[model samples]
Target: MNRFMQALGLSGNSGRGKAELGRMAGASLQETAALYPFALLAAVYVLGTSPLGLLLLAGGFHYAGTLAGDRQSRAGGSRLLLPALTAAAMAAGILAFGLRPAGAAGAAALLAAAVRGLITGRKRLWTGVQIPLPLWGIALSVILYVYIAGSNPPALTPHRTELYVLCMTNLFVLLLRWNTDQVRSASPSYEVDGQTASRIAAVNRRLTWLTLIPIVLIGAWQGFGPLLLRLARWLISLLQSSSIPAEPPKQEESLAAAELRHMAKEEIGGTPLWLTILGYTLLALLSAVIAAGVAVLLYKLLSKWLPERLRLWVRGLLQRFRRLRAIRRAPGEQAEYLDEVERIEGVPPKRWRRRRPDGKRQYAGDDPRQAYRQLIARAMKRGFVFRTSRTPSENGTELETGGRYTDYSPEEVRQLIARYNEDRYGRR
Candidate 1:
């Protein structure tokens, strides 16, 4: 493997590329997904149509940006794909809005998301905690608004209200699942057999059904059928507005006034419009509060019922998967993967043997096989020109003569290079 890579590494680099290494492929799809919900919430603050299209466009662009950034981290990453991707995103935004009847605000949001996602990918910005930065601000604003100003944001329209309810519901579920994942991580001391693991999984499955059943029932009861559903919907419509807009439309005013007069029997019962409006508003708010509380209570019960042994089973399964993948990969890919692992960890994963004094597994080694790789990564980071024509020994000599790696003596560096050459070619 070393012989093949070394031969390839010496193949001169102007147009010819060198062996790619040290790719950090950061940010999982979930963590990246977590960012966009907040961006959607930010758009929700303006409140006309739901920014569903904007949300979808931004998410695709963000994922592409991260993928492109990951590729560009390797050798030949920046060749042509990045500029093309940026141009594609911009063109997509233009066509989506210009050809379609999409709003101007939504189009502007799409372009902003594309640029932001690209910068995030190229710079590989660390999202603070596991979520994005904007979530923190949005959360803080909500907290301040509720506690200090003393009211919820004014009047979400019917569609906006429905989406807000569902999205918030899903967010709580994701948050609970996230917490379960942390608790599910296997601790070193605990262990479980196959039967016990299966039983633990059964408990989790039951708990999931336990939570989901009530939520389904609640949605069905409120939203199902025609007669009762229509009456429920009428009450919802009454809550659709409280204080009319200052410069109210004439047609809308007449319809609302007619509806209120007929429903409350304003002439016969002599009820004021504001009093009827308050009653409808209170009914909707109370129903929403009760539903949210019940959902939360169900989640709590499910979370408490989870067992620790499930985490051990999960860990065993993951380790088995990793071992299987290692066995299946082609030889060259496997060698490069191991080398890349060593580059990131300072020691290859395959080399962990013996326990340190602290009882942790020790992986301390100074293998001279790493000399060439260390020198190349160091030179690249320090802005030296990359040339693959030089052998490992020649590269070390150049670095030394040019006053790089000054901490090591010339003779020590030379000796390390010698061992690398011997180990590299001795079999041949």
Candidate 2:
């Protein structure tokens, strides 16, 4: 037990362990502080209202505002403000329109947040939003279904279908988010090579095509009219005729036995195939349309007013909250590579050429040759092999020819080689 406990500690020394523990505790506290508002809002939407719920709601809004303020500071953009306003608008929508409309508003707000995260390259923020958005969607669906079912018996079937649609839509949103992340991170820099660009473009096109399946399904449902009901009835009649015993269970049977038998026969035979297809296709199309619209709107907003306003507000907020100084620090991992690239670019071309002790010329000053070599090293780590005799450009050409570096292109390779060749041997 002592060994196990020691193993759990940071280096198993009380002083260092205590400091590490403190840091972990602080991080946990910060995370909880950030998340409590969303939790409270979720509770307000999911659980029945009470005085406590109202208090939580107020606290949640204030906390959300604080987070918005912090996010604005970090991204130099109005990262949080849009979502906060969106939430407020959604709440007002709930009051004015209805729960379903509010749910749509919530979805729009979530999509907007995701779009902002994607545009700003805030992977952590995007991922965090993705996790909760789906949960909230599912919870809202359940709550709405219950509310609708309780209010009117006849509405249950349609409401249930709507709930399924919502769930499917949520799933498609997740898929799109995943695909978008994949596309964005496909290359190391903003200027993706031709191959990487083509790959991303292809994936996006495939996603678009996949979207048509749902649209077609929805259209077919609209065109066909109640095919699911007809199919279900037909299946039920067939089952009743073939499987169910003509005679009722004997009186000697236990209540449990009779109930089980009845349930087995009565439970609507699994969802009709057509209904399943229709639900999925409609939901997918709905989700794709909403996500696409949100992405476009985000692009426009980022292109115009929001980013400047965010930077100003964040700068002011940072000045006021001196304690939140840590949030202002540059993200290390992301900046490190960018800094290296900038450093390489900052070097003068004349300084990049150096004569070796052996009288051979080489590219110096941490040039693109070094970056290309590093890329090769990384590829080796990922199980790619290159012959030592081959020059970096030759290897790059070989890789491109073999279709190995899907994330890079032959032109990019040639550019790197040209730079290297210029440094080694003066351009003719």
Candidate 3:
């Protein structure tokens, strides 16, 4: 045993040992890949541009989803085509949108990998339903951007920005369904039979509900959005200001060119460069604070509404107010009485009981001393003190035999014992 323990705790760094570790890690990666073919797409999305980035995010979610499904079914296959096609389409979109060639190709390769997984049936990805992590990242981005940028200027662009934000939001919902930890943890409360599928389904259902929550919250925030905008403008006015001075147009400029330069100079004078920088910086900071606050609030709200099993997990980490729901029984008189008797006797239920003729056993339903009283009464009637045997016997116990104990007991004691026995074990 000592040798086994030592072996279990041993560490090694030899070439052969390192090789084995590498092999193990490689095998694990391959297994993860076959299951979640689009897992690789996530990295690409973070590095890709606009549509390409968003597409990869979606692909990652779909891939994660396929993994969840495969895990649910316990079937193994490389279900990669959907994600790959989705990724490829996204790359094509990036190219169409005028992103550089290298970026587009990189995206295309990622999509191809997903496609390959789809075509192959050798590997499968599995995790219970989860919202993709990237989708959450995007939502965080949107919240931050809107809070900082508002409806115009450097942050909010043409209508495309809104469309992109909406797309990211949708992806967030899908990701939550496939990957959110809150949803996964909350599942056990609704799952009675302890089946994984039921837990997974319940988690998915919760994600569907939660996915819309952030959107709704942001929309509500927007109803009061103008107030925040005014506040931001006021703060911007306090920062340092800068302006570019105009130069004399000596000889070569045309009428139109000079007029344009004059307008440019006026615009530059109106908003200082330093002020602009400070404004953007302040906006970014405020946006960050707001996003963090919203995230915390959302987490708290969901944590409260979460099923008990999931709440336990959430509280285990947060150490927040934990609500433990116990089975609520009716006001039970019997339970109270039993508790009192046990407190007096210091004896447990298992220590007292005799098998009845009907194949049932009786113990202290309320009072523990009642058994002794009944035994004494039976002994008095039967003319002898019944032996208290450790083993079962056919005849009535010493208490049941009666007689001897009648003379032994004082009159007062006998009367009290008799009264108690009659009131208890008697017909009532």
Candidate 4:
């Protein structure tokens, strides 16, 4: 783990800034490592029924992705074809086993890797949209299980440790998803500083805790589940019983009312169900009241009795915490402050030469297509229109022959467009 973080430039207080080809490869590898579990879950739980080969293939796929990222980093171009091609091959292999769904998922993963930062309609050379592919895979896995099993698996009791594992796994995946997005979408020139990194860490912790909310809610439901079900049945029975025509009357009361009376007297662990329910409800209410009172008392006591120096120190800590919280909320201020601080501290901002844009959404330093994009932007800026419908070659010829559009040589314009076309479409 330590070695992995170091390799990715994601270790210690200041590792994850200023995107480089090497760092990009390392980050891509980490994302793949995170993805390996998806294959495992599928093998163990997703209807592959424990195919060990999938895991090995997944590892190979990630290794390939890492290599592709590293190559692109060193090569100075936009071709990240290797990772995508590797994924396609994996998909094909999975399909050959007749596991169509798993094969489909692998194909989806391929697209997520391969088409990044490529021309896509209105947005030329745009990064692929980020999606929680693992989450989708999990959902699909469960759906497949349900379809194949004839009936859904038995309702899980809270005692199953795997449920908690799955929930925590869910939290982990979400955090990785967030971090991957953060790393990929950042500008090439951007550097992640200590405070920004800290803020990201804080958000990761918050998200990890966020998953606990649902787990806690689910746990709480266990206590209420039976009662709720009984009440629902009672209500449904009452609604249905009201219209019963041929029912024998018991003491001039309807069947539902009789059922209610019977339920009231029903024994739950040697105590009447109604009495047990009342006792639990009263206990809960009493506990809530006492807890609230204690909280209020603590607040009042702390405000009144805390020493002046301690109070000030606490307030300072709180202010610092608030600043941390505001990092994402008020990023503009944070950005300015960070830059200003870096300048004051005499730390030259570190930068890395990008081989080319890969899965990292950042535009690479020597990216072949970047120059063409600049030309397009400049053409738009000069109050003259380039024909959007025409190919780059056609547009270049039109500009050169038309003779009214440029301060530079018409031949230069033609050559520029030809080069742009060659890089954008002709280059493999």
Per-residue lDDT tens digits for candidate 4, residues 1-428, read 45554453334343342333333433343344344445445555544443336544544454445444444444543544645565576665566445577566655544444333121211321122223443454454444433434444343221133333343354344445455445445634334354565566467657756865665565445433454556545654554445444555578888898888667756432334555565556556655775786565344334536788877886778767766775667656334232100111232345334333452223324544554555454445555575433556665565566554444467666666566557655832
The residue pairs that clash in candidate 1, if any, are none
Q: Identify the leading candidate in terms of TM-score.
A: 1
* C-alpha local distance difference test of each model: 0.49, 0.48, 0.44, 0.47
Instruction: List, residue by residue over 66-182, the lDDT tens digit for candidate 1.
Output: 555544543336557656765676577566555343444455565555555556656655221133343343344344323323344454232333343333444444444434333
For model 4, state the Cα shift of residue 409 in Å: 56
The digit string of per-residue lDDT tens for model 3 on 1-428 reads: 33432332212533333432332223223323232213223333333334335444444534443333333234443355365466555665465434766446545644554443342212332223222333454455555455435555442243333434444444443444334445446665533444564557566757666865665566545433564676567766654322334456668878989889889978875656667677777777887888887777566534545689977776665532211111133254432221111123355665544555553223334442564444444444656433322211212233234434433334334444454446554621
Number of clashes recorded per candidate: 0, 1, 32, 2
Q: Candidate 4, clashing residue pairs?
A: 76-355, 119-125
The alpha-carbon deviation from the true structure for residue 163 of candidate 3, after best TM-score superposition, in angstroms, is 6.2
Question: Candidate 2: deviation at residue 76, Å?
Answer: 5.3
Question: In candidate 2, where is summed lDDT lowest over 10 consecutive residues?
Answer: 335-344
Candidate order (TM-score):
1, 4, 3, 2
The candidate that wins on lDDT is: 1
What would you estimate as the lDDT of candidate 4? 0.47
Q: Which regions in candidate 3 have their CA more than 4 angstroms from the true location?
A: 1-127, 130-132, 143-156, 159-224, 227-428
